[model samples]
Target: MEAPVSADKLRFLIYRFKERLWVKPLTFCLLSIAAVFFAKIIDGTPLAEHLPIIEQSSVETLLSIMASSMLVIATFSTGTMVNAYTSASNSSTPRSVSLIIADDVSQNALSTFVGAFIFSVVAITSLKNAFYGDAGVFMLFVLTCTVFAIVILTFIRWVDSIARLGRVGSTIQKVEDAAMKAIDHRLNNPRLGGFVQPNLTALKEQGAEPVYCEQTGYVQLVDMTKAQNWCEHHNACLHILVLPGDFVSPNNPVALIERTATNPTSNKASFESTEAAACEANDIIKVGHERSFEGDPRFGLIVLGEIAARALSPSVNDPGTAISIIGSYVRLFLCWAKKDEIRDKPTDEIVQFTRVSAPELNTKDMFNDAFSPIARDGANIIEVAIRMQKALQVIAKCENKDIQKYAQEQASIAYKKSMNTFQFEEDKGRLDETKWSD
Candidate 1:
């Protein structure tokens, strides 16, 4: 499917681009090459003559140290990151690896480290060839000092970031950031900036024909532009039944189409054109079992659930992690609940003119997606249950009646679940009543 347009689309593209492990490193490498040449230009300038003096031997030694140490640092950083990813997958959830891998600080720190190494090697080569005079040599020494300082600072920060990179708390934070961004967008554009049409029953009564999915998997993205274009070209109205994060089955109806034919020949052409449009719409709707970072914010919620599930597993038995995940679930829900803007105004006339319809994502459905697994597995864990109850109670304060009711119901279920699991009244009593405190 063509990817969702506007803010969500741009955010998705930028995220994927920046998440690349090599992007910053490669960019730094190029900049290092530029800096080297830049230093050459500044070497013989009048400004270079007044630059602080430094010995040839000192620079040579510094270059050698940087060259050797950076290579080791590169290897070490790679190994550390690999280990972090492994640990996250084992202790937390594998789905979170993608978010952690995209950590901006970690990527930039690694990039600076690698870039410094390259700069040193090139600087050393320049020195060996006697490429600089006293001024150039002096400038190179200053640049090297700056590089050293950067290496030290970057190393310090990288150490701190890597320590928690794939840990449960960090993973939850990443998922929450992602989900909240999506939810906020959804809150503003409930129908995703498209038309607010009737349900499947209403559309079916209007003689709308169903468009079956070509493949079975999670609907990652829908190309609104392409789908709308297909409808416009065929003079049809397409009503979407599925959205991103929806699991589709092969030959299942994903959208229902209504043909608008005014001419008698157009009536016959309408059926044929509707079939063609359905095929094109299916092509426009990209589906796969693996959820993508683009289009859907719910994927992040699902991942947050994964973390809770893993934390509750017998091997991990980490209630704190589950609590953290539940907290993130609440944060995301609040963001979704309070959201009021679509985040991006439609850029094209077609989007505003088309009768294409997209459904609003329900908070209750996402609530279940993020918390049900933990509720199922960690019901017996007092801390997890209490935290979940409090989290829901906090959300209930939002004053949205339906959400409050849902929160109370989930809290009730949690209490009942704990009661069933606990043999002692003391354990059950601990959860029977939860104080509503921030």
Candidate 2:
């Protein structure tokens, strides 16, 4: 949940916007074109006079070589990226593919090569028109040399990054970093700096304006600021019905508006205002086909869990990856729980929390989302089950009761699933020997 799509307040939109495949390349293309314009403007300048001039044939040959090479490089990069995305979608969670494809190093490298190609093309086209004077040619020549150096450097880095792209551990780390940023934001603004939600009166059944969802999709974001300000303007309270990451249909309500205007008004006007507010609220709630990670920390957890699930599948059968993911899950939980502890502690710098009425991410939900699939897939494997148990036991030792409760609950489920999987007394006995409490 966040304010409307203002670049500063809408956290999720900012995250997605920055990672777009075109942002960097488009920017660099514009810069490259700007360079050509600057060269033309400075054609008679002293700066251009000091620049070295090359033969027209030499410039033409270089431009042709660069244009052709860059075209091939761009194609190769695109193909490689597609392969990486496909591999990540299959090997890791499908959700993870977004982050892998948006990686900075790869995107920048592609942008560099692509921009170089455009620069060469523009220069060659202008050359045919006889646009470049002696000074402009010298400037263009210097610029070409600079672009060449960048292409070489970027190609090296791009190769290094491609080698690790789509890897399970790398993808997991990326997901973890995203989750941590979201967790930090929540820890700072648990209520989104709004009023407490749990105690807020449920007015939807009591004549509140209903904001119906228009489509079936996950609730990606709710512009709480716009909604809150609108409600304030009308002397009403904006109540969010579904938080980000929750799936909804057209039948489901996204928010409920309770009219709290103290002035007695005609029923006709009141009804009109309430309906208008509902319409505006609907505009503020942004639903999308896929869940995003900006405000939804659970998305990261779910993705990491999916990675473990794939590893435990019979076809992939990689217990080591499962074990590694168990540790990762534990670390992720500790990060979340530790932040909760920090936020709860009283300090001079701490301000009173504005506890907005949104769904609290339950420890049980995290446990179920992260472990159930793994438990189901690795039921027959004792080693995986043991690692799962130990991972839970570690979290269970923490003082957080919800964490302990969830850890114990998943532990019981893991054991029960193993009960059916183990045919012999020895395997069953081995599982039973260790205790979640201990």
Estimate TM-scores for all models.
0.83, 0.88
- In model 1, state the lDDT of residue 212: 91
Residue 19 of model 2, lDDT score: 63
Note the Cα lDDT for every prediction shown.
0.77, 0.77
Every model's Cα RMSD, please?
4.5, 3.6
Return the top candidate by lDDT.
1
Model 2 Cα shift for residue 282 (angstroms): 1.8
lDDT by residue (tens digit), candidate 2, 1-438 = 234455324566667766688988998899988887776876767776676777766777888899999989998998998899998898888889888877989889888988989999998898779888887777777788888899999999899889989888788788888877766766665544445454435464577766788789987776666665565555666667776788988887777767665776533234455466667668777788999887877788788788888888889888888788888788877776675575565542232322223445566787788898889988899898888888888888777777877888999999899988999888888888764654
lDDT of 2 at 301: 79
- Candidate 1 lDDT tens digits, 1-438: 233464555665677777689988999999887777677787657787677777989999998999999989988998998888898888777777877788888888889989999999999998999888777887788889999999999999999898898777877788788777777656655666567667779768878888899788888766666667666666777788888888899667988887776565552334456566677778867787777655577788888888888878898778887887787877777776564323244445214536588776776787678778887898888888888888989888885666777777777777777778988787777786683333
